[model samples]
Target: MANTMTSYTDAQIMKALLTKDFSGIGREFVDDVITSVKVGAFTGAQNLDKVSLPSVKEVHYCAFQNAAITTLDLPWGELEAIGFSAFAGASGLPQNPVFSKLTALSNGAFAGTSDKKNTDLRTISLPLWTGSSFSEGSGFSNSTGGIFAYCTALTSVSAPELQSLPTQMLYYCQALEEVVFPKVSTVNSGAFNYCSNLKKIDLGGAITRLGSAFMANASKVTALILRGVTTVPTLGSTTFNSTAVKSGNCYVYVPKALEATFKVASNWSTYASQIRAIEDYPDICGS
Candidate 1:
């Protein structure tokens, strides 16, 4: 007697694949033993390495948790919202080689240590990210939850359109030397906690807030340029204590409009001489 399980309908197979229903008959159905998988009835699997997802138009939770996906290339799309731990522990995908296409990433979309072993990623470009996570001092700060935390080979991040940085986004990228922030509006706490090699931080005129410990423990950052910042919060004590900001060895350039504010602030007064109201100067990182 031979095994005689009935074949599933195409609609059923498709539903299983889209939902990741890897159980019982569903598993055997997608094993490709008898039929090929399809996306929304489309049958060609060749050149399908990149799959486009429907724009999540509403607030949803855990959209893709523990998924087996290897890469994602979202095009001119917007994620309305994401639940906590949306992309947590996706251990199968490799480091993204081209991240410029991603316009937005929801909170905790790529959180946790699931993919820490695959650290070959070197470059990233997100042009439209505006969330606080994009701010160098927010929750996405280098010492806290940055995706590339401890990724020593990362050299540069060119996000000219990013408006904010979550805390600790690039906290300990030891090899990072240069960064270009175009439309940044805020830098939150612990943004670049211990990036020892970061030498230059150029902020456009949109920034308004500077959080606590924004550049703490970065000994190599010698020069800083602030053009559009108007409200300079108290530069927290012990923050930058280990870096050039400690012994008044680093040069801090501020717009003339902010010269008075820096001079008045008690925390900034100590370094007032090092802080100059200048328009331009040589590259901070010796590039």
Candidate 2:
């Protein structure tokens, strides 16, 4: 095929979508022509990409399993919510859903909250995401496991605008390596559970609650930096788990004035032997 671009009527697109056929569509379609997409419409197509619907305001329950979509660009200004498993099995996808202008998302819209059946894509970089929480019942809670539980290739997450994290958001992502959440203040349990490759984390001071946030059995963490947070959040029994102490290389750095406070807190005090003041480690910020 020439991979050409052409016009498609709403009726024609709807027909192909309902039949699970893309034989009449092109690799790139114009968004201005598409107004709506039905639930489970594009479930198993193999060659879809570049769906430009600048006028579309919402997309309800759709699937794109094993599709060739690379670099998604949605009409963020009008997009309200995306329903379950929109990109469930697209293993080739290298980046997370890019909600450039949209603000809201629904349950299981990106990946399953409990099972590994729908999430084969890797990486979750919500660059423009700015919210305290996500729709809980939407994805993460419906499944028996975490949202990224089966995303074995997933390696990084960068959500700078978010202040809090959902529970088990990245559970069992064994290959995960780097995380950058500079604005996050709170995190739910098992948020980073079983992320074996993660090495370091840089969290902001607004943090007030933590629920087994960074528990792991094979953790490779060596540096943990908390910037200016005063009152320690509620720490889970396994929040630090095996990461709190390493041979002699691991260090937890807090504000210069609050080192004493951290060393005396309940769960945090358990790692007091490894905790230190930020001034003690001038290189904590990697300046």
Candidate 3:
């Protein structure tokens, strides 16, 4: 009589891998099967030049680390979170993956990579982040770390639900021209430290704490409009003193009710001549 052998189906093997069960399957058997399946799936897929994973709703940590994926087109609108160190050291992938649908990024989501050279990643629309904690050096760093760093063409950003501005979010975006933080309530330190060309900053009536060096060394900021601010904190001896505020030439506007409070602050008092109640100057462009 001829000898007989048992065979397992692909679904059975995949289920075993997912459950981490190797009772009947040998270690080599599992490894060989997984490797072959992955290779075949990647090679047989359509559009090998531009692989688009639209069905992937969530990506865990190190999901694609050290892989050969050169380009990723993640356009899934349902993607809500990216695990920590998810794309860390993914040298083969582009610096900026086109994700027109990604809404949230966990801590260190794209950390530890030296492949950001000549990357054109300028503008991002994070409209869903209501309250998020970005630790010190927890977010993007390095020359390629700024949220919109080196994006020479980036001119404007509109986020209606953004409650806090993370530290170093716009660290070295030298070409940023305008930023509209309509709902921003808190601004951490060094938020816009080295933006040399930043010209217009419109902080709408919701900000409370302006951390140290919030806009330090941003000489090009010609207009600062604080529509509902009651106080401007001091940064050591320098305070909020800039050529724009010291010359008494730059325009400063405040709410009508907070005129007394604004006139009492030492930083604002020096530029008192430049301050005007918002109601009095309805037509002024820079407030």
Candidate 4:
């Protein structure tokens, strides 16, 4: 039964949300004060497998942290932000959930693992993303987790318009295998940390700088395609120190004319043995 007695105190509202009963809560009340889902409102709502999100613009902290949400009619264009741990423990979301116009995602916004899986690029979009790292420049610090950390089912991602990747963007996504960022110029620190299955990175012509620990502990990365990058990226001693790229086991495929340049560049020179002209890998990276 809907709690029809409308006037509610702070404690009463908390009790109503905790009980998972919002039936008779009139739309007027919802639109005026509950525009956003209250924090921790549905944290463990196991029966909440589908969400009706048309009236909601934002989801507050831990609102549905561990809910059984498998489907939602989310207004992607109108939804602006999702709070920290909003869907952290929900393991039933689709592998390719579209975020058409979303602008902000707090730490661990969708952190937990899920059973739904796939390799879809448009699953997450950031054409309107304007948030910066909460732990900016402090690459490996655990202070801020990525929007999709520990998402084991997500296998791939491609953000063609993104220029810079924040720290730990896809940290510990064990199933992630490929990344396509044609216009990305700077991949920040620890962006792909511990992604064990990651093998291909197509930075194309735009990448200029790779931050500290950019691909740390990503041992499966065997293909680094910089098709038109004429200038070697700024590489420090530990830029790729912990990845397969630094150990001479992977191939750094660059434009044919710049093969020599990469082989002789600063830290890149150290991997001269692994540097190769893109033309030679026509079967793998195309001509």
In terms of lDDT, the best-performing candidate is: 4
- Residue-pair clashes per candidate, as listed? 27, 13, 1, 0
In model 4, the Cα lDDT at residue 195 comes to 87
Candidate 1 ranges beyond 4 A from true positions: 1-84, 92-103, 111-120, 132-153, 231-233, 280-287
Each prediction's Cα lDDT score? 0.53, 0.59, 0.51, 0.67
Number of residue pairs clashing in candidate 1, backbone atoms closer than 3 angstroms, sequence gap of 3 or more or interchain: 27
Give the per-residue Cα lDDT of candidate 2 at 194: 69
TM-score of each: 0.63, 0.73, 0.62, 0.73
lDDT of 2 by residue, 1-287 (tens): 11123556667666666665555676545555455555555576545555555566556554454445544555544555554455555433434444555444443344533344434456565566554223335434222124455466677766678776666666666777667678888766777776677777677748887666454553676777777487766776666656635344567777878888888898777778888877777775553
| Residues forming the 10-long window of minimal summed lDDT in candidate 2 | 136-145
Alpha-carbon runs more than 4 Å astray in model 4: 1-14, 18-35, 38-50, 67-73, 76-78, 113-145, 228-230
lDDT of 3 by residue, 1-287 (tens): 11122355566545444543433333212122111112122211221233345445655544443333445555434566555445544333443343444555544344332334223344556566553422224333212123433333344455667767766566656667778787776777767776678876766745565676677667777666677565654423353555455544455566778776766776557666676677786655443
- Weakest 10 consecutive residues, lDDT, candidate 4? 133-142
Off by over 4 Å in 2: 1-12, 24-31, 46-58, 65-81, 91-98, 106-125, 132-156, 242-249
Candidate 2: global Cα-lDDT?
0.59
lDDT of 3: 0.51
| Candidate 2: residue 30 lDDT (0-100) | 52
- The C-alpha RMSD of each candidate to the native structure, in angstroms, is 8.7, 5.1, 9.8, 5.8
Q: Regarding TM-score, does 1 or 2 come out ahead?
A: 2
lDDT of 4 by residue, 1-287 (tens): 12233454555445546675433332212223345776787777644445554556777677777765456445656666777777777644555655665666667777755453222222565565544322212332223357677777577564555666767878888887888777666677888898899998777645777789988899999998887576888888888788998776788898888889888889888889999988988987855
Task: Provide the lDDT at 187 for model 2.
Answer: 66
Model 1 lDDT, residue 18, Cα: 57
Give the TM-score (vs. native) of candidate 3: 0.62
